[model samples]
Target: MEHVVRLEQVSSQLLAVVRRRAGVRELSKIVPEACGIVWNVVRAQRVAGAGRHVAVYLDDQINLEVGVEVSTPFAGHGEVIGSATPPGLTATTTHYGPYQRLHEAHEAIRQWCASNGYRPAGPNWEMYGHWKDEWNNDPTQIVTDVFYLLVADGSSS
Candidate 1:
């Protein structure tokens, strides 16, 4: 039930931020709160007068030496911050289910990319669309788009 999809070039303006170090155990607790921190900034933008979406891009591996940075101004305590931009190419797909299943969709895209001779460049970010109402529970109604930044032939820029 998975398929390959193309992504039109997109550039997003995001507040800078730095992600704090966390293991799988700590991630379960930190990620949600970090998302909230970012979301609050998104909401405030709406309150001010912007009508665009903001997303956080994470890298697969953190450089313990260099650390990370988020461009988004909103940040959690001790977060490494920088603005996220799309790499030149990406393998994009839509995930229609609860947020919990996002990992499954990501794995599907990752495998697809590998089979097709593409390697992942960074952590894919989910672009949120319309707010979910009761339909959130219905896998058929829920819609989440996943984008994997890709590097063809695994070349480093």
Candidate 2:
């Protein structure tokens, strides 16, 4: 799919996350498990949530912070702890399709970055839109935003 990629400065989005070191291939399984743990903590503590989940990829090894968005930062419950997506200039795109195809959006951002001479400065992330019942039948309704934190040099122009 054609992704409309853009560069923007975004503030950190606070999350209750669980850190995990998984291989690229293990993400599909591990992320959900970690997110569930994060959610459980949110529920158990009655933390106000924003109804969305995010996964922050910290490195090439696929070390990541997977969790749901919370209204405010809170204390850790075992492995689930407070974290946030890094604030910086980023190249981002919104993918409207099934989650399994989110790689396309990430690739689009990478391609855009390469052509535009913007190197990734830090972590990248995916903020998943809230689930809708209709999305079950219409995969196009699913929304996942992909972002790559760009090196904060004056090269974004």
Candidates' C-alpha lDDT: 0.54, 0.88
The residue-by-residue lDDT of candidate 2 on 1-157, one tens digit each, is: 8999998999988899999999877888998898888888889889975458899999988889999988787688888888888988889999999888999999998889888888888699999898889998999989998999998882753
Across 89-142, the per-residue lDDT of candidate 1 in tens digits comes to 777887776656667777888777766777777656665446557775565666
Lowest-lDDT window of 10 residues in candidate 2? 148-157
Predict model 2's lDDT versus the native.
Answer: 0.88
Name model 1 segments beyond 4 Å from true: 1-4, 16-18, 25-28, 41-57, 62-82, 152-157
Q: What is the lDDT of residue 156 in candidate 2?
A: 51
Candidate 2 similarity to native, TM-score: 0.94
Best-fitting candidate, scored by TM-score: 2
